[model samples]
Target: MKTPFALAAMTALLLPAALPARSAADPVFTAAAMRAHVEFLADDLLQGRDTGSEGHEIAARYVASQFDGLGLKPAGDAGGWLQRIAFQQTERTNIPAVLTLTGPAGDKSWTHGTDVIVGLNPDEPKVDLSAPLVFVGYGIENARMGLNDYAGLDVKGKIVVTLRGYPKGLPSEEGAHLSATKAKVAEAHGAVGMLSVATLQSMKARPWARMLTFANEPDFTWVDTDGQAHVDAPGIRAAASVNEPVVAALFAGAPQSIAAIRKQADKPGGKPRGFALKGSARIQVESVGKRVASPNVVGILPGSDPVLQREYVVLSAHLDHIGISEAKPDDKPDTDRINNGALDNAAGIATLLEVARAMALSPEKPRRSIIFLASTGEEKGLLGADYFARHPAVPVRQIVGNVDLDMPLLLYPFTDVIAFGANHSTLGPIVANAVAPMTIKLSPDPMPQEGIFVRSDHYMFVKQGVPAVFLATGFANGGEKAWGDFLGGAYHHPGDDMNQKIDWNAGARFAEANYRITRALADSDAAPLWYQADFFGDTFAPNAKKAAH
Candidate 1:
């Protein structure tokens, strides 16, 4: 007997044929067209379209040309198709950045990549610090939740060591924000430096090797109007992720062991207490900074309704990917060297283009304008999207919602999609309504532990109070295993190129689902709204209208 999921998969598999055929009036999103876009963007000639690279510029122009050909109006910086984002790229110098510990036992120096990974401070050419260490639990301080990890602990002029995650009970969004901005919190608490240690679960999810793979990759910050990179609140002089072993070593003379702390942090409602460690840390950092310009391609489709046309819905996909690997396999010289981010993002951009084309060529226009944004610097901490969100081509308040197309792993006959950030706003029901006609299942996030909601380009919009959802192929019809295999093998590798197998039909279906969602948002009488009393709404956009039933 086939399971319910299997039956759903079968039903979905039969959908393409059973659905009405596309006519000249309604443009069909074809796999061949999407593949064409992907092939060009992910070509080796584009050198993986790294942010601020020449290949990236070429890809930006190509997207602009496609948007122009589709008859979409240019909506970017200074009445152009490209929004230039200023970035300050910083790299760590070869000069050995060191972390030394001093205790009753003796002084010991830990290796950079092995026992610790230090983040380069671009503002400071060198950071030399020697301060007492304080264990600050998960390093989260949320006043809304009445949770302050720094409470009862004074870290002034001290090096605060903390775990990576927040308590399990806090809302995912709240916890994610706290965890992400812990560095700033530490700075506010008058800490001179910070040392982060991963829990067992975090280590297993992202191994140290994977974390160190891009150690040399340049870190970027959006440049301010004064032509200066935005700086954090003053106080933190140095920060690094210390190895678990190093963490255990730091607690050598303490009453509680590092293992005990990890055990407590893993439990529900668990709050590890902060304590002063016997040891003090000395950290040294050296950095080199350079500036570059990256362009985000933008195009706008006007709406039929004059009033609704003033409101805009955004469709976004990142155009950048990790470029060529610095470390090449000497034995496999014949192998491809470029990290052609096919599914990582080229597929996403292709999907965006197809959707834009469909909307532009349709006989009926949406009620609200749709903005297609192909962003850059997503690989560099979502910088492009951040800049756009901060300085939008359209009035920021007029932006209604965002539908982000990132890596939709279309390796199998997917029957469902995982829409990150769907639950927070009316966009959830909108997405359900959009996909109901197509008979596609909408799944909750399968791997919430990875924090998929806040990691992508859509997050920038979300931060600015715009409701957003990022669609990805979900765990159905062997998609779980296929997605895992892709991540384990080809993700960010040279193998993520055209050589990998692709299910064109799946790609087409993915695009179709996104187009429907975008159309629904654009045509809806009421704009997308945050759920009343939602954490994100209360925190980011308290004045946002409540969703209409």
Candidate 2:
């Protein structure tokens, strides 16, 4: 394959030059200014701004400097612009060479990488357990939905085996979020451990070899004020994802064969019934972890109105990337190995900084204070944002709204934008009004299957009852091809550097739109409220007030 630079250079030459010309370049949010920031943040020296790495700290400091230059007040930890957060990094040190299953027929063994892929627990460094198995269809427990996979089964002190993914009929947004909580459901159901058997569908989507590669990657979780890792339910001792062969072995002599369960799950609206498996699986995992600290650079532009000043409107963008490349070795030594994350988030941070500059320079200040937050560890499961939500710099209740900037595709002159979670709250109209001046259409999510609503830093604040929206350039005017090409070629790879066909004007417009949104939220008579009966709002803030649609 050609080098990333070579490919990007070629793509740049193919891009059309029919973009609309700016009437008068905005002083605050200019393409030149945007380019300057992106050039530095996505520079080769920063290495990819991985969480808790020196590269990330340097990136955090750069954002802090930008915040400082904007004359904003420090809104992070204790009078400083950077919120130093502690994290616990976990990596599997050892895995059992051969995992064995004991059944009524005989003992069967399979090696680790071939039949199963297991993850290490941060809370438990060393764990060895053998317990009776219970196959609980999807292992979901949502009392609100009246769906409890553990209803009839008594899985106490047993290893619960569950099929991967949630029920197929649910909406993609909710389905994705629900699938993420299955592990916690097992823990809540008093299971000693959880094993998820890969479905035929899941394997086809993501092959077993890919699963094995990611299984060895390090896992990180923020350390709370109580010195506890804020990820994974503590009740479960070990967890593993197994292939079809291993799953068949566990289901031997059961009421339903593995094939039957697979077929039932494949059928529309067919819920697989749970039953106790006539086998006991044994698992052992040894993990090593250490405490490290990263910074979430934050600053505030205080409001003029005393009453509204007490309330806050937050503007956030993640400052970290996927770190370095993990590509295979080849004879081509000229291949660029650093994942620069130019569009993945360096561009987003730059957009946020420009917005801060614009907001700070406005003679007419906002009624409510606006916090400019450049978060760390966003690529690592939104850890920094989650930490800030649980342990906030300001009063959590006083924070009114959040606008998170994350990976806005700045390649094309986007005529539309996708505001994720816009429909869920009053922020919808606000976002629409904010972008209307530029004649930019507020487009619906074209790729809801990506589950972007719950995947970004803003979702953490939403979980804390803050009405939030994530903005991105929509798939319009050849944006679909750009997005497809970038995601396939440059995303998270060495190719996401400053050499790509980055439209700086689009970056500026994105910043301008966000600045308007933040200002409007800050100056609004009332804070953004959840639409009545919204899932996230109802789940996170049950008793909070809601807005009529």
Candidate 3:
């Protein structure tokens, strides 16, 4: 609610009035420095820095070296930089997935490639499904929208095939059936299996967005399911309704056409419905599973005040990228094979390094400990962070705030930084107040649709009731359109390489700005907190909402 100037004035009141200004000659962050780090991390030699790979291992060492050079103390478990994790990487292959339909005539078996393709469910061994396939409309259940696609049928142990995306154009609050939340709905309905059809557009463009899930890797989680989760088989592929002819043939005499089914799913009063298709399926998969290890590099700077030093302020950045993709049908060059991830997170990690260096050299350490956390497996699902929060090096209760940096370079030079999940917590004010002096305007989270808040490693901390923030540059800020162009084209693609053109000076200034804000929090007496309105604010105090006035 306060102006940036008012916040700066308050900050000035907290610190010495005569604090000396940083010298112009002081080394600032530069793109050259960031590019230098990216060169190796995103280099062809790193082989896309795949988790548990030798290349990612090299990257870990490099980041650790930077932390070491900054004189940061090892703050990991057992006082080691690496907190080792275990995982299994599985690759399935050569399994028979057959389907057959028995009608008034005889039984006709469906071929694997033509009728359907099978994938394993996280549950291992084998998952054999022979139940009738039900078209559960869009599989949406919304009270407000009056849409319930699963109202009648008992789908337990059955495979529910549905479409992707929400209704074409409807007020979101009206409960237009959303395809995004179907996985949870499927699980809740006791449905053992789910098959999501590509959107009509995606079906027309590409058959399906073929997914390559990681097997449990030593460094990251391969299977993206709850450990307690059960799958009838090791894996399952919910088949896609890609080809129109395929849909037509499958639903030959069904109650509703595929389009009509999707339409009904979008309307109010859409209830659990069923249709019969004359087809049977057989599924099989053989996979290669391996074990590997990855690390979340951490370095700590203890605070000046003994009592407050026990409390911690964490600064984090993910250090991994989307390693390599399975070779696609349209082959390009060797260079196109790797995803450099220069802007996605290499820039973020580089900025964190600079922030740590600056903070370590500050005139005085703040009241709380400052932790430099280089998180791994962010590309996967923030696995390193999840492990860290569960098995903390320090007490989770002692962590006051977590400031996470994702992609900060591409959108710099804007009027302000986009502070995501601001409405969710009290830390928003602290972040806003801290960065005021840098003329860095902090505003509410911009791209909530992207679920940016939930997507980052910071969410792991937030879930634990630790106040957290994820900072990114914004296109809405006063930078060139190229900034947005860069963010869009190279976010997670192979073309995100470090070349000649980049604004290194702006990056340096941005790093400096982040350093100052971190210092402010580190030195402050009051701990950062989540506002009562935040979804995770109640984590620390289960009754926080009820207690709110």
Candidate 4:
């Protein structure tokens, strides 16, 4: 929270009647409004709103029109409401992927889709190998942590099958999770292809739901490490690993138990052993890739005062989801397709839209320009937000603050709104003062380890020296299990629908709270400052004006 320099200035200058009386304890979040907006955005008519698709274009136009109706001006090039982003939508083509293994008994072949699942690998999909299969344990190569799965192994261009996650007894005190990191290390070691043996439930063939909406774009190209282009390779089929007793094998001495192998792999003498199988192994796969375009929508409600108007405040929310999912046994009866990202972001968008409307209705305009951004491709690695941060529509340095609205399924009784990056700026006091009347708790960041502060669209602003705030309903709901259940299950999957039960009144109340805060900041006279020790302070330090040139 930035210091209340603007609030103080406003109080000093305004006559009592001239200023809008701060409403007393108005609930800003409303379940009804949230549901209405979500129902519109996530309805079957939207078709999951995949990026760069016709449905996505419809969504963008609708949102832009809404902003225009709220009296917000175009913040994009040529005074357009949409911030057009050039994106490469890719689709996979028919690519041959084959795996063959020669063992004592004979040779075996595995077809794609049936044998393995693959991450996006570049073109030149042919991966032919006859190398020995070595169990690289957990596939991690972190020497600084005293764990190196690739130790004492020559895995160059060979098949390196390993377990996911880090080695046992490895401390997680650091932010490092070895799963994704280890995969990169394996790739660096010249492993032609990597495989993670499923230990939890053996593989079950996951039902193919519709591909994520973003996957539909034809401009989407699949790339490998070598940057070669390839079409869709077969997807890895989910299957269960079984012991020889569950299968008739050609009489082998291979390790039959996953537990035994895991235990052995942890031992000091358990260097990954390369082995020749008594029988051959075979793999086959089939898949497709397409390319498309999506954008991060931006509009500015410029401030009234000339000097102060140079500074900006930002409000943002992601407008994308995991696209639609295919039906599974766990799917609900009414809705069998489309992962309607209701609470995931449709609700957040509603909050954003409502705030913009309320601001426009207020008699007094904000001192600093207010930027309302609706970003696309958040589910696809935060690409839209990332691009905006790199190429901002406004001068990035002129932006003083950001507020990102993420999740709000239910409001608690006397619940506190947790603000991530609470210590990063002086805006804390201002936020507190605005919400204090309503008795809303203005708590410090709740889960820094979850990295929520750095996960959303506001994160892109924060990275660019802008003090940003991300607010969400309490995960615990004043320590209730029901809220936790809603978070764990419906967060990103298909079940996050509109009729999932929500406190609409609470939502409206919270929305009102946000409205007051945004207005207060906008009507203020001074720029919000980064906290003294905050990371962004150095970039906008008081003395850096001379050096900025």
Candidate 5:
């Protein structure tokens, strides 16, 4: 167990008299009731709470019960506390996947699990297609950014050879979003498939061998009411990432050399132009899948104000984790294989529960209604939260703001916090004021290149035109080293159990910070609005009211 910070007593500042006082030996974490929640949720018996598993169902029931005990109204389906979601989980069936390129020189082929690896296709069980190839730099088409890789190119009824990542030197979050959804642009142009050849930079980050290992992981997408799986660009029949050899072949005898394209992509503000290649590509793969179901626990705390009560501020935390590893006789007898995910997010859920308790016990009710959500399938590409955002328990337009709690590192005393996406909306000052009284500062995004803004549950809400922020303990005071150490070792591993060094006082402080932020959003006179002319605001909610930056 890690020792509490020197200023551990400051935990009492959280909710400021929300819970009973605790002795010096027993801190506010226990008094605030997070310790019990964390211990139970992160216990070995929960089996890591894998999405759609029995363990996860148990975890969901526990969260529902906690909400029920708080006297909160059920906000889920059919007057119940569970918003059930169906998913289509898929994995490759070890078929001999193959990709062929026919060019001026000759026909060249590469087998999967080696020079190429195809991603799982949730829409098709088996795919066989051949289409002409076109090289599109970064495959990003955004008119607002004044840089469209497909500006002068037509990929209709053909396969497009694209770079793996976004161009250099765009706004980190906006660039990341454009790059991530590049497939949709390809579909819009009637492209039949995507042929992604990694840049030298991307290959350095994820080498061929490492990419091969990750390619084996299963893929998931939520199912619609019609029993069809969701795909961002369903029109794109297939996509495959190729290595150096395939990249060379894709650009052979082209107007622009691959080496020059690589050089341009290696530097800042690289914009390699797109062109038609000499040849066509054929892609083939087989996918095996099964239908699975999970639930998002939803509870409503009614607002006191008659008018504002119709509006809502959502507080969400993901409850599922990576599952356990299979036991092998070759494994060491002392080896513990369960990935309990104590900090990977059992801690976040615990904090959410405590925040709920603090709100329920507080004498004053919020002006706007509050929804406390324990979402499942977050580890599976934010599936649960995405489902909820698209199909909310309440009207999606009624959600004015969202504060998502994901992976708060309670390893050290954080002197500051980071609210991702705060700068894009009026929520910035609200977050700032909430933590100021606790002697905590608000910091800017320290690692912008990681594109963390679009990688959490709140991003799902943001896409639905809701102003949202993902709150996490910042890298300050011993937090930098603590974050690095945990990420390098325990993150997503068996070492993330309760056995690790977890400072309860830090957890309490983190919970309090989120509580204050939620209370402020719910009580504020005006709903959170995107800053004027913001990219996300214009793109997602173009006609909505906006705030001055």
Candidate 6:
């Protein structure tokens, strides 16, 4: 039996041949061209392209200039290529915030960062919290999952200590929703403070040292039209992430052992229970805030069809990366301090630029307009993308689809690509068709446990009911070990610089696939639509109109 994907690929191949042939003189993606872009953007002179920093502004200007050189129309604020994103930055003071637990074994003080990492609510810069501690398994209140960690507990004015993640067996989206809303759920239940303990899974993914590396990094939130920073779980006065030993201390006199509770939480289909602890907690933190501006570079390529031109297909990539790290003595004598973010995202932006240039120079124009967006503050929790989604230059409804390029690790030769969120919408078949002629297999996410679908800039579009897909080089043709080595060694480290091994041809192939995907979305008669029974569709776009067939 021919699968729907196979049928779609056959139709795509036939239709492309029927359309007017593109000129041979049209600009094609080349490894050298892509390398030029990546090299410039990822250069150490850019100082890691930190959001709102001078280096980031320079990078933004470079992208804008590239758009101008390619003759793309400015599609950002005030007819400029830059859409300035207003942000509120919150920085914690260097003074150690304190966490003291008074239990059966007597009171114990935990040092900040060493014992627990504490952060005060931005709304309340200085908070002195003295409240009873309650153990709420995961602190989740998800009715859809038929589990409420706080259902039987009255946590009014108490500090809720919860595990980091959702239940083991729930669907990823469901778990993600529950986990994301845990803080708000706790606040709604009258909790005054929150203390999060890393789960076994989280601990394995990131060690304490890696987690503490960013302890001093500023937290950013998009400023609203009213100029107020967006706040989540407003009433929570204090929050802290405690180490494993601290978790043990918090449960010293509890009815059940912390080990037993963690065991239950780790088990499949396990539901850890909530209970009150025998003691109280004292939490304190101090923070300050400042307003800053970042730019999201946007440009538009008008389509040939007047009617279809009103609709748009968006190609997005984040342009920001973690900035220079403080100089520290390491075992490696030649360790680079700047996190150039070559593979983390400079590669993605380079690919976006190449795609834009190719589309601009192509003789055959797409039917729908294509928007090229190089967003900022993605490393700071997708702030720029979220802001743009909320306040778009065009109506959000007019965005037909999004193809996001982020961290396509071109570390080795690759025969396949992974398209996250491919299963959720018509975009699935479109992507299949796009990659079919390239002789590249579209593989499923090998690491579903990462919950990557909601972790990138495309997720902001998905939340706005736009059908979107995020592309990454897949683990095939000996790419798995390459990927593992990259993540384990250079993912966010200074080693992510251009000096690291990069397959330029692989990058060119990545850009080519993206270009094909974008062209298909822009030229297709029908817009992308969420699959009828998709969880995201049901939850986010229940009333979304179907695309014309």
Q: After superposition, how far is residue 124 of candidate 5 from its true place, in Å?
A: 1.2
- The TM-scores of all predictions, comma-separated, are 0.94, 0.92, 0.77, 0.65, 0.93, 0.92
* Model 6 CA RMSD to the hidden true structure, in angstroms: 7.3
- Kindly report which residue pairs in candidate 6 clash with one another: none
* Model 3: number of backbone collisions: 37
**Comparing 4 and 5 on lDDT, the stronger one:** 5
- Candidate 6 lDDT over 1-549, as tens digits, reads 667998888998899889868669545678898899989999999999999899999999999999999999998889999999888888888767899998888888886778688875657777789999999998887665688888789899999999887889887755775688787999899999999987777788777887787777777888888987887888788888888778888988789988888888888877889999989999977888888999999999998999999999999999999888877765476666889999889999999999998899888888999999999999999889998888887899999899899999988889999999988888988998988988998998788777888899999999899999899999999889988898889988889988887999999999999988998999898998987766787678989965432
TM-score, candidate 5, is 0.93
Higher-ranked by TM-score: 5 or 6:
5
- The global C-alpha lDDT for each of the candidates, from Candidate 1 onward, is 0.87, 0.85, 0.65, 0.61, 0.89, 0.88
Write one digit per residue (lDDT tens) for candidate 5, span 1-549.
755775466664655688766544321335236667888988989899999888899999999999999999998889999999999989888677799999977899998878888877888899998999999899988788877888889899999989988877888899888888988999998999998888877777678897886677788889988888999999999999998888888888999999999999989889899999999999998889999999999999999999999999999999999888667789998788888888879889998998888777677888899999999999999999999999998899999999999999988878999999989999989999988988999999988877899999999999999999999999989988998899889998899988877888888888888888999999999999999999999989998999988
Candidate 1 structure, TM-score to reference: 0.94
Query: Tens digit of lDDT per residue, candidate 3, span 1-549?
Result: 657998898888978656766665344566677667767777878777776777778888898888888788997657777766654554455555444443334455544445454443443534455655666767777654566778876776666766654454433312221444576676677665565554453454344323312221222253322433222232233433323434555565666767766556456434426553454333343344555667788899888897999999989988878787777777866537678777777878888988887777766656789888888777766877877876677888888788899877654456577666655666677778877877778876554334567678887787687777788775555554755577557657787777625566667776876786787788777776556443357534454322121
Ranking by TM-score: 1, 5, 2, 6, 3, 4
Per-residue lDDT for 523 in model 6? 88
In candidate 4, stretches whose alpha carbon ends up further than 4 angstroms from where it belongs are: 1-36, 86-115, 122-287, 327-335, 411-414, 421-434, 443-454, 462-465, 476-479, 488-495, 516-549
Q: How many residue pairs collide in each prediction?
A: 0, 0, 37, 76, 0, 0
lDDT of 5: 0.89
lDDT of 6: 0.88
* Ten-residue stretch with the least lDDT total in model 6: 327-336
- Residue 522 C-alpha lDDT in model 5: 94
**lDDT, candidate 3, at 80:** 72
Model 1 weakest lDDT span, ten residues long: 326-335
Give candidates' CA RMSD values in order: 5.8, 6.7, 8.1, 9.8, 4.9, 7.3
